[model samples]
Structures are given as C-alpha cells and as structure tokens.
Target chain A: MTTVPVRPPLVRSSDRIIAGVCAGLAEHLGWPVRMVRIGMAVAALAGGAGLVFYGWLWIMVPTADESAKRNARRPASPIAPAVSIAPAVSMPPNQSAAVGPSLWSDAYSPGYPSGPVAPPLGGPAAAGPVGYSSAANPAPSGPYVAGAPSQAEGTAAVPGTGAWFRVRNMRYGKEILLGAGLLLVAAILIARLLGVEVPLGTLIPAAAILGGAAIAWMQLDETRRAGLVDKTKADQAGGWARLAAGLALVVAGVLVMVSGSGSWEQTWLALLASVAVLGGVALVLLPWGLKFWRDLETERAGRVRETERAEIAAHLHDSVLQTLALIQRRAANEHDVVRLARAQERELRGWLFRDPARDAGQLSDRIKAAAAEVEDGLGNAVDVVSVGDTAMTDRHEALVQASREAMLNASRHGGGPVSVYLEVSDGGAEVFVKDRGSGFELHTVPADRLGVRESIIGRMKRHGGSAEINSSPDGTEVRLKLPAAAEDNGEGKS
Target chain B: MSTPALDGTAGDPGRTVRVVIVDDHAIFRSGLKADLDPRIEVVGEAGTVEQAIEVIGRTRPEVVLLDVHLPGGLGGGGREVIAGSAALRGTTKFLALSVSDAAEDVVAVIRAGARGYVTKTISGAEITDAVYRVAGGDAVFSPRLAGFVLDAFGTAPADIADDELDKLSARELEVMRLIARGYSYKEVAKELFISIKTVETHVSAVLRKLQLSSRHELTKWAAERRLL
Candidate 1:
C-alpha cells in the first residue's frame, strides 16, 4: 500500500494576518487548541523566521487527513449519469468498478453541469458514520455524466480522473516549477512596489531557493518509487547527511548575507554576529544528529546479535543439555557416575564461556587461570601436563576448556588413579586422561547420559574436535583432540 | 554381488529389514554386507549427502547406518556429519557409528535423528544387534556408554541413619552383611574381596547402623528384610 507522503503539521507562528494558520494547522494534525497555540509561539521564535515559513506552508497545504474525513461525510452519490460514462466502456469491468484514488470524486464533481465547485463534504458539525464507496461511476445520474463526457472529449480530461490516468512524477515536477516561478515573480513585483532597487544579486537568492527546490523534488521522486535507502539504514542516512548539508548551508547563507550588504564595517559586524549565533545552533544540532545516527547503527548490530544468540541457545538446549540430563538420571552409583557428571559440568561451563574482544595476553592469562581453578576444584592424585605454545585466541580458549572438561571427567568418573598428558601434534592438539578401572563391554552405552554429553564429549565437539575413550575392565583411557594453531608448532612438535 | 552363506535368516522377509549404508568406507560396507544375515536387504548405499539423497529417494530404506565421519564431512568433523546431514533428516532412522563415544558426539547424532549411537570398536554381532534395535525404534549404545548412562541417571542416595553416628565405618558394613546372612568368617572374606579380619570390622559397623545388640537379632532382621 503506497500512501501519499504528508509533511508533519505545525501551527504557523508567522501568521500576522489572522489566527487562521494556527486553527488550520491544529485541525490538520488533530492537536489540541492550547498546545497548537503554544507550539506556534515556541516554534516561530526558536525555529527562526525560516522555520516560520515552513509552518505557514504546512498550514496552507490541504491535509489528506482532512480530505479523508470530508470524504466520509459526503453523500453516497452515484455517477451523475451512467449513459454519459461511455468512454469507460472499452475498459475491463474489474478496472471500471475499482476504487477511485482521491477525495476529489466525493468532494466536487468535475462532470457537474453547473460547473465544478467545492461541495460541503464535511460541514462544521459532522455527525454519523460516513459511508465510503469505491464504485467508479458514483456521480449522480443527470446531464453531468451525459453532457460532461461530450465536453471533456473535446478538451483534455484531468489526469487521475473518471476511469484512468494518474498524475505522474513528470506532472508533479511541472506543477512544482510553476508554483516556485509564481512565487519568485510575486516577490520581485512586491519589491518593485516597495521602491526597493532590484539588483542582479537579489535574483541570486531566488535562484538558490529554486535550486534547493529542484534537489528536494528529485529526492522525493527517488524515494517515492524506490526507497532511497534500506529500511534499516534509512534513519542513519537521513540524520548524518542532513546534518552535514545543514551546516554547509548555514555557512553559505552567512556568506550571501555578508556580500549582499554593501557597508563593509556594518556587514562585517552583522556577519560575525550571525555566524556566532548559527555556529552555536549547528554545534548543538551536530551532537544530537550524530547521536541519532549512532543509535541507528547500534540498533542494527543489536538485532544481529540477538538472532545469533538465539541460534546458539537453541543448539545448546536441544543437543547438549538433553544428553547430560539423561546420564545424570540413569547413572548406577555415585562413585561410578560422578566423573561423567563432573565432566559434563565442566563442559557446560566451557561452552557457556563467552570471549569478548581482549588482548592476547589477557585472554591467555584468563585461560591459564581458569585451568588452575579447574585443577584446584578437582583434587585428584593424577599427573597433569599442559603442552601448548600458542597464545590464546578465542578459538584456543574453546579448545583448552574442552580438554580441561575431559580432565575433570577423568579425575572424577573414570575409576583408578589417573594421569593426563597434553601433547600438541603437527596438525592438532591432543589431551589424554587415562584411568585404571574396570571397563565395560563395547556397544552398550545409553544415548541420553549427560556426563558423556555435557562434560568431555560435548565440549570437544563444540570446539570442532573429538574425544575418544578406550577402556576394558582393567582401565580406561580418554583422549581429546583439537585443531592445532599455526603458531603452536613449537609446542606440538613433541 | 553373490549372497554370502552362514546366516540364511537374512533372506527371510520376517527377519529381513531393508537397510541403507552411509559410511564412506567401501571396505567396511562390503565387510558388513558379507557377515550380515542374507535376510537383511542392502537397499541402497551412499557416501555423501548427494549420493545419500539419490539412493534414499530411489530405495527409501527403513534404516540407515550412518558413519559419523564421511568424506566431505559437514562442519569439518564427525558430529557435523551426523547433525548437519539434511539428506538423512526424515523417513529413515539412523544408527551412528564413530570411534569416539564422547557424549557430545552421541548427543549430536541422536539429535540429528539417529535412533542409536555405538562406537566403531563394537563387534560385528553387536552392530547387527544395534541395527535391529534401531530399526524397531529401540535405542542401543556401547557398553561404556550404557554404564555412562546408567551411572548418570541412577545415582543412589547415600543411606545415612541416626545410629550410623556410632563411628562404625565401611569395614564394619561388610562384616555386618556377611554375619547377618549367616556367612562363615572365611567365606565373608572371599565375598568382600577383603580379609576375614576386615570383614569382622565391617560387621560391627553394620550392627551399629541398626543399633542391634546381638548377632541373632541382626541375622533375623537381615533375613526378614531379605538383605541376606
């Protein structure tokens, strides 16, 4: 659904002629009377006389909201005469019956025999629900439709009228140019009447205004058909670019004001004063605009982060946690099961560890400290060896944590006195934790056991590695394998 | 290929189950095919998702024995091969094979729709057994995994009693059970994997858990409770 772009309505404070501007703007925006009056006063003073022109322009423009309301209150009048609507005959039935584009059809009839005049669509006190009908031949039957087609056939029909035709961008461009030219001519005539000398320089200001209008028109045209920016990037683009353009314009306007005034000393003083005031305003606005721009960028980043987090969380819950819960629920003895459970616990912690951007030194130190903590927490009479020369990257932390989890599991679950050997190979790192204990027959493990799921195995898998256990009744051996870092050749060579 | 002899049950429709093998190793697949009952039909074989999808589409086997590490392993590992195999997501039940019985690897395959997970070290008969169980929607895992699972799920609460404060230790526990069950002094030693004197010490602790006065009462209580 393409909606016509409407400017924000504000009361016109520069309305010295009457209170009509304030009343019209308030009606357009549906603002309260008191608020509209206050806004007119505040904006006229704060937004400068230039913004006062903006407010006045908004007051003069007929708001679409008002047109919509008026359209609702109008009587349901059929097309004045069906017979005169002959030109619509060649069109498809579906197109002929579809809704008209504008309130013009309901408000005033261009086909009326008496000639087009604004109808009292919405009187001051509009009571009751307004009925809206989209039927194409809605004007009442009379000479209006019958006689109207004959006259319009010889003359040009208004675009977006009757059955077809729409006011395209080209038409809009011409209308804007016509309106701006009229305004320029009016200003020139007014200056002549006031006995002010018309100079070549005077025309320059009008020409600049025309140039600004052309640029603004092109922008609106581009946005109308194809959005000027992606929806996510839209806010930032507007804020940053507008801020830069506004600052440049302020500088250019000051330069123009100075050169336009001929008295060197007076112009210099006036220009300095204006620059100081405008510069202060620009300074205040720059920060506010930049803040808005940054917020837009941050919002986009936040959305990406949230999506990634959800994916990670779902993976953890559906796969890893379920296994741990199963194991913990079915383990036969406290002594027999505690090791796997502890391994799973360590594994869960490792998977949950988030590495923020930090210096290599800080990250490695943190991992080393974490390793020491794991050792202290599990007091096993086992030989523990650490072999890795690479400074910790985020990836390395994940691998280290997985090995630590396996060690924890071996110490706690795999029966017997244990020993851990960490070795870095040419292409990968391997950590082996062996325990002398009774091993079970092959191919009888349960699927949902958590110790295997969460602690030793889960961590390794998450780090893109693997863990294997080789055990018989006499003993058990657990090995963890991880991808070796390029710099870890020194450590892994052994 | 000529059908191998031995277990003619493979050709019996009642015993035969349609199977699709998804391992990368042709040798392993051929070996599995050779040893299995002739009743079990090798419906289709594939080594990768594209091949798997093609074979599965044509054969639509009821069961798939998927290796956790295949050529072009998804995510560059075994678990990824299991979890990210979109070709095996529906219709067919999978039995995962891996050298690693790591809990995460097992969970990954299970979550990927494998009905069971077994280590590659499993014997041929056990693998055959697993296939049947997975086909029947019953789960199977290696013995180590079974112990892992059972221990994980079946932690018995430590039984503590008010009389346990009597300072009778674990040694006394062994002795009490043997004495209550009418075991002779030397016999109790063999049962406990300990010396007869150690069994005697544990019997005292067992007596203390009950706060019982005599062997006669302890034996009667143990007999009544069926602990003997």
Candidate 2:
C-alpha cells in the first residue's frame, strides 16, 4: 500500500558536523539542514530529547554505503525478526502504530540490525513487510547492539548500554560546561515540580543561559568540524559578532539570575512586550525576506539559460558591432570587408550555436581538431555534423587526411563557411566536405596549383578508396569514400 | 510593431509568400526583410512575445519567421508564440529562426507545432526558399536540425514503447541521415535514386512521427535534453 519498498535507505551520512542525525533528517524532510540542526539543538538543550534522540540514531543508523551493502546481503532477516521480535519494540502496540507516519515507518522498520543479536523486528503493525519509522524505538535491552556501523569489530567497540554516553573525541571543556548546565536545568525543572519555591525570574534567565550555551556549543562544533581552529578568524557569525553575542548573552543571563528576585509582574510584562515587537518586526520583513531569497534563486536558474545568449549579446557588441564602427571609419579595403563579414559570422556561429560537445569518437575529433587549427590561424569557420562512427582503423588515415586537405583548400579558395558530414556504417565510411565558395573547374587548375587536389584524390585512390570533386559557381563538394573494413571484405570472399 | 511596404514580384516564380518576422533584433529583422527575395512580402514584424502573437494573430500570415529566443511573457520564446498561435496551425505555418542551430529551442518550437527551423547564417535566398517551402506546406530542416533530429531518433525502436506511430520507416531513416549529413533534397534524391518530391515526403513523415509520439524513445531523448 505504501511506496516504502522504493524509498531510499535511512542511513546516516558521513557529511556531518554533529552526529549527522539532523542532516540526514533534513534531507528526507526537505527542510534546510541548518534549520533542522537548530531545531535539534533547541530540543536537546531544553528537554534533552534531541541529545538522546541523536545518540540513539548514531548507534542505530549505519554510517554510509557500507551498511547498505550489509543490509542487502542479509536475506530472511526481516521475516524471522518480524515474527519473533516485533512485539519487543512496539511499545503500547496498537492499531494507531499502523496509521501514523506509515511512509516514515516503512523505510526504517525493514532494516536488518547491524549487531550480532538476531535482527530486531519492526512495529507489530506493519505485517506483510517491515515498515520502520524513527518512532519505532527498540525496547532497551542488553547485547542487541554491536559497535556503530562506522567502526570495525576489533576497534574500541561501543557497548550497547553506554552508547548514549559519549566519552570519545574528548570535547572535554564544552562537554563539561554543557553537562553542568543541563544538570542545572534538570535540577531547576525538578525543583519547580517539587514546589521548591523557584521564582519566575530565576527560571526565565536560567533557560536563557542554557539556550545561549547550546547555540554557542553548536557553533563551536561547526568551527571544529571545518578544521578552522586557531587560524581562520571567527567568521560564521559575521566576524566574531555571533560568538561574542553568544558569550555576552550567557554572561548577562548569569548576572540576571544571580541578582535575585525581580517583580514577577514586571518580568511578564517585558516578556510579552518583546514578543509582540519581534512578531511585528517579523511580519513586516517577511515579504522582503522571501522576495530576496526568491530573487537569488530565480537569478541562478536564469544564469544557465541565458549564458549562451548573454555571451553572444556581449560579443556582438565587442566584435560585430565594433567592426561596423571600424568599417564606417575606414571607407573600405578588401581586408575590412572580409573582416566585417567574418566577425559577423563569428558572432553568429562561435558565440551562438557552437556546441563543443558535438564531436564524438577518434575520427570526428581529429577532423574537428584540424578544422580548429585552420579556423584559429586562418579565421575560416567550419561546421561539422557527424552521424555514426566505428572504432579506429587503418582505413581512417586516408579519410581523415583527405578531409583535412579538402578543408584547407576550401578555406583558401572558398573563403566562406565549410561543412563536413561523416557517416560510418557496416557497408562503408563516407565524408562529405562542402564549401560555399564560387566553384572551380578541377582540370583548368594549372599543374602547380594542383597539389591539394592531387593529394586528396591520389591518397584516397592509394588506400582502396575513391574521391570525387564536384565544383560549381555555387559551391564545391569533396566526396571521400572508404570501403568497408578488411573483415567485411574477407567475409564477402568466403 | 511594423509592416514594411512590399513591391509586388508578380513576374517571379509561383505566388508571393507573406511572412511575419518575429526577431527581437530590429537591425537583423530589417536587414533580412530588405535582402529577402522579392517573392516574399514582409507582412509584419515584432520584437517580443506579445507583439509577435498580436501581429501574427492580426495578420495571420502564411508563414511566420519566428525567432527561437524572445524577451517577454515568462521567456518561453518561440515556443510560447507557437503555443499562442495554436488556433492558426492549419492556416499558418511557423519557420523558426535563430543565430545558431540551437537544438533545444528549435526542438521546443517544433514540438510546440513549428514546422522547422533555419539558422540566421543561411543566405537570404535560402531563407526565402525556406519561407516559400513552409507556405507551400513543406518543413525546413537545416543540416544542424537534421543532425539533432537524427541523434534524437537514432536509438533502436525501443520494444519498451509499442506505439506504432513512433516508428520511422526505413526510407524516412535514410532521408533523415542524408539530410543530417548536409544533403540537400535534390542531392539526397539523386543519391538514393528517388525523386526530389519523395525525399520531401520522407522528411515530412519523419517530423510527423516525432510529433505524433506522445511518449517514446524520441520523447525521452528530447526530454533528457530539455533546456527547451
């Protein structure tokens, strides 16, 4: 009933700053990873839900591609676990489990456990196939977890019970400070619940101190992850403004908490007033903020589509438009006339429709490279369209060499656009080089001028191929043909 | 918007063709009109989407020299104009024009019901010939467009998509490849030992097959290439 079987695996990513719990979550939820991180930080600091949740994920979630392969190899694991251990994890097992977040459960529920313990079953609700959701927490038990999927068995394997208590990576300083603050938060909350006379002023600033500490802790985590410690200036919060503000907020919170009982009425009034003002400000700036981000995204999308045309438009001004201005000033020479037309053609073809990726295979690539050489030095543009190709063969030499000569001659005499079309099939390979120059009679060309013509024709003839030259006032087409390969010829004889 | 004065070329072959120029460049549009064969009358001109659609709808010219890129109405370009002129598809034909043999925009316009496209680098006489061909119920496929079409349809008839209309006849494949290899209709005819008209028919049939395919290999090929 669900597309759960088709969904991507719920794996923790290596691209992480903290445990990658929120980052992986953000990807699946289509929320900004930053927002998810902040939300988790808040969740962790305020109630310790996020910290427990993240540690549980860190132990349960596989690190990357390695775990996915392991999951694929374990056949029949999901079924036995579903039958034997389904009831173990499904706390308060009921029909409600089947109904809520069905898609979410489907992805995670089916995963086989990484540990030596028999793979844990999904919630009892998902019957036909295991549907695992983050909500499907395994009943806490001994010997169920091996080390996290990241570490090998021989390494310092994390014991199952202590997995939630992180001791490695020695973030000793911040860890102690945050641990004490969380203890203080728990103490305050417990005292209030026990009717231990905790005042509203103490509670408010106490919460502030913990929140500020959490924000700073996360920022420090990001910095250390970036490997910018001690060298790169504090820049994430716009050059030390954020870190200082965070530290200052923590200090101010401490001071306010120590100064002791302010009027409860005054604190409530100030809190409501600040809430209203910030709400009004957010409402006022919301449209502009949305527009700013939207405009940035729209510009990024347009940049790709408009790049070719924009380059052409920019070059049209740089070359062709400037050439017209030069032509007007020069009152004309042959060079200027030809230059103007060439510039225009360059502006049209070079800037506009030329896709360098158009060429494929050895023959087309070599022929195009030859054309590029002529165009770069002599300034004649060639358009090449290739249909099919074969692997490189000895027969390629006559075809490529003849095509190059035809191209050079076409540029020299044709003095206009040249086009080459290459087609290779089982029968044979053929290349057509057509030039838009006033045609020449092949025989009328004197012997001395016949070098290129004789070379093209004679080279093809020598290689068991043939060349045809058709010239007219309109254009000239050099037809070069290579017979099919030796294997095909041998087959015909047999 | 503008409509240029036309000097009747009654002596020229066949009837005079009425065409609307829809390029955003005023200079190129004017120069093209000025240099075009006398047999083609410049019926109207426009530089943006609204004007092109308005001009085309008002004049209902026999052929529209539609620019593949435009500056208005969500930047749909020539495809947008062709889409706007959907009602006039029977009466008016679209001949796409662009600076290069830009495959996507040309394919977009063609898929949006344009007959075919020619690059701006073509000779004035050739453009006139293309316009005449469009007006006479023929499509213009430049060598570049032919190359693109050939590539788009080159994959074997996928047994995966069983639509009969998506298949091209052997004659059409031969015609398409020849055209892609820069063979003019006459040359292709001579090479294949068929009449020039038969080559035209095969070319038209290839375009029709591509247009008729709602979902198939050709559509998938073009979809993968959809900067269109």
TM-score of each: 0.25, 0.54
Cα lDDT of candidate 2 equals 0.63
Q: Candidate 2, which CAPRI tier?
A: acceptable
Worst 10 residues of 1 chain A by lDDT: A124-133
Q: How accurate is candidate 1 locally (lDDT)?
A: 0.48
Report fnat in order of the candidates: 0.00, 0.47
CA deviation > 4 Å runs, candidate 1: A1-247, A250-259, A262-494, B1-17, B23-41, B47-54, B67-92, B97-113, B118-126, B142-228
Q: Tens digits of per-residue lDDT for model 2 on B51-169?
A: 99999999999989988999997789988998998889899999888864445666667888888777776677677777777776766777777766766665334343555566656
Using DockQ as the measure, the top candidate is: 2
Model 2: per-residue Cα lDDT over A166-265, one tens digit each: 3223324555666687798789889989989877677777777877777677676544433211224434544266577677677657656755555666
What's the DockQ of model 2?
0.24
lDDT of each: 0.48, 0.63
Model 1 TM-score is 0.25
